[model samples]
Target: MSEVPEVRPPTVTPVRVVIALCLIAPFVAMLWVGSYARTGPEFIGIPFFYWYQMAWVLISTALTMTAYQLWQRDQRARAARKDGASK
Candidate 1:
């Protein structure tokens, strides 16, 4: 009889935690409406509420890109490790 090896679930790593934060930050910021639902602090005639949301658009794009890059790097590292272990 051949016994099959057990497959363990992947553990949480710091890289993954950082990646999650990068992805979640924008969502958390925008969803917490009370934090930026004000009209003061105008920027060049634009209300703070308007500019803040617009700024988050760019910030979200950067964060999303960063998360994607980190994910790609993590995947490549994982693949290398898997190949090395199989050999």
Candidate 2:
């Protein structure tokens, strides 16, 4: 009887770490309310708290885009590796 080899998950890479950070940074910043709860700083009469959240809306979009791009790159690299290994 032949034994089947176990397939292990890929190890974490620096690219993956950066991708994770890109995805998680917005959540962390938004969830950590106390950090931006005050409204002392005003921009064009807008309170800091409101403006900060609004700013994050754009920031989150950019981060999400970056994460998506990184994820696609990682997937392509993994696929190439897998194909090479199988060849």
Candidate 3:
């Protein structure tokens, strides 16, 4: 009888860690409202409190996209590694 090979779980990589941070940043920023709750810095009449959150919306989108791309690349690399190991 032939025995099945063991499969190991993927290890954490720097790219994955960065991707996690990118994904969590927006959530943490919004949750910590004290960080941006202010009115002194206004952008063309918009209060800092409002504008900061609005700015994060765009920044969050970019971060999310970046994290997604990194995640895809990481997945591909892992897949390739698994294929190589299996062969």
Candidate 4:
């Protein structure tokens, strides 16, 4: 009877850390509501709180894209390593 080897998850690299941060940014921003809960600073009459969330919408989009790119690179690297190991 042959035993099957367990497949471990890929190791985290510096690039992956950056991707994690990029994904976490929006959650951190919205969670810390006190920082932007104000009206004095307005963009075209939009309240700070409202504008802040809206701004995060765009920022989150960019960050998500960056994170996704990083993830793709990591996956490619892992796949290459797996292929090389199997040969």
Best of the candidates, lDDT: 3
**TM-score of candidate 1 relative to the true fold:** 0.88
Off by over 4 Å in 2: 1-9
Off by over 4 Å in 1: 1-9
Clashes of each: 0, 0, 0, 0
Off by over 4 Å in 4: 1-10
All candidates' lDDT scores?
0.90, 0.89, 0.91, 0.89
lDDT of 4 by residue, 1-87 (tens): 996685666577788899999999999999997899888688999888899999999999999999999899889888887887677
lDDT tens digits by residue: candidate 2, 1-87: 996574544679899999999988999999999999998799999999999999999999999999899989989988887776666
lDDT of 4: 0.89
Cα RMSD to the true fold for all candidates: 2.3, 2.5, 2.0, 3.2
Residue 71 displacement in candidate 1 (angstroms): 0.3
Model 3 C-alpha lDDT per residue in residues 1-87, reported as the tens digit of each score: 999877865578899899999999999999998898789788999999999999999999999999999999989988888898899
Q: What is the lDDT of residue 18 in candidate 3?
A: 99
**Which pairs, if any, clash in model 4?**
none
> Candidate 1's residue-wise lDDT over 6-48, tens digit each?
4433768898999999999999999999999999999999999
Q: What local lDDT does model 2 show for residue 84?
A: 68
Order of quality (TM-score): 1, 3, 2, 4
